[model samples]
Target: MQKLSELDHQRRIRLVDLHEPQFERDYPHIDRNAALAALHGELPDGQVLKGLDTSHRAWSLVGRGWLTAPLRWPLLRLVADGCYRLFARHRYRISLWLTGRARCDGNRCGPKT
Candidate 1:
């Protein structure tokens, strides 16, 4: 497990403080099955909030050696694989967009489609 930089650590704390309350307000009735899917686990809402608070902090701290650590290597690989899958799914559309952007007069993506 890699350690977080001081700046990243502060950022994570601020983000958690900002978002934790929103999560509580947004999912007051988080026991509902519909809420379970959004919670990302079977844990109660408060626990879910805590997990998210930590997970998102970890996410923000990625790419600073943490991503390449033994514990996070597989997760990073999975993220890369997911990116490839997304590119495959939207390859043609992305290509078309790029092509249009290349031919744009300035930087307007080819006259707004």
Candidate 2:
């Protein structure tokens, strides 16, 4: 997310961390559980877009439009969506393995009491 923000030279993208207390208050229209479970984007018009749709739009804003342009093809889009789902499903474990910790703060990723 930091990398993407840096690439967004125009400052058009606003990356909100789902763990923030103000998230629910700020985006009451979005489902907290659903947003926590996957990637989500709240457009300026208040539309809550999710998953690969949000990703492509964000990438385009960061000047990496070519990265998701392949999704314009129906077949490629289907395949990419499937892959994204797979990754999202296991993201926590993957992050732990890669970073030696979850991507989120310890309180959020730690075992519930």
Candidate 3:
């Protein structure tokens, strides 16, 4: 019964889990145009700017993920995925808090309710 019950939470958790690391790995590369789009709610359209994301940590940490889900298609999706990488920021990384650096959940995420 324990296994069966966890199975349900598994789906929802997995949905977030499955996409987390993919974002973490690709976050550093979030381009400038993408950053501007995130900031202004509009794409570069025709601008040619580079080096937009020198500090990927800021948006990924303070910013929210679901807010960027609308862009989950084509090139824009990559930017959305960058949001996930925010969790990987060194300050929030699991190892920084945990003793052995093992698995992390709601408890490990931050202060408890």
Candidate 4:
């Protein structure tokens, strides 16, 4: 499994913090279900918040409404085999969305507060 990078983990944490309240109110009954789903298996972003993996290449998992803010539904590894075919390659530049690496000049994707 690809290790979760600092930026990625932090991004998830931020998203979780923002959504915890909604979870409490709207899906109060499904907290257990959500946790269960995340733990039991990997799903698409549009399917659930957990398990879905992102890549510099293409979606390791993809769904119809996956790119939206509130992912509409959960999707599984339907995009894996040749999933890389879906997107243009993204040679991740720490400078593009992260910084402080040897390949970067500290120009962009600077340190977070």
Q: Give me the candidate number with maximum TM-score.
A: 2
RMSD to native for every prediction? 17.0, 3.6, 14.3, 12.9
Instruction: Single out the weakest 10-residue window by summed lDDT for candidate 2.
Output: 104-113
51, model 2: CA deviation in Å? 0.7
Backbone clash count for every predicted candidate, in the order shown:
0, 0, 1, 4
lDDT of each: 0.42, 0.80, 0.36, 0.33
**Which pairs clash in model 3?**
32-52
Compared with the true structure, what per-residue lDDT tens digits does model 1 show for residues 1-113? 12343546444332212134476676564543333223232233345442233444355555343433433356665675455456645544686797754422442221233
- Residue-wise C-alpha lDDT for candidate 4, range 1-113, written one tens digit per residue: 12333334333322222234475674453464444323222234434333333231123223222343222224425444233323212323424555534432354221233
Best by lDDT: 2
| 13-64 per-residue lDDT for model 3 (tens digits) | 1111222446446444444334433321112353322222312222223343
Question: lDDT at 53 for candidate 1?
Answer: 32
lDDT of model 2, residue 18: 70
Position 56, candidate 4: lDDT: 18
Range of the 10 consecutive residues with the lowest summed lDDT in candidate 1? 36-45
Judged by lDDT relative to the true structure, which candidate is superior, 1 or 2?
A: 2
Sort order, lDDT high to low: 2, 1, 3, 4
| TM-score winner, 3 or 4 | 3
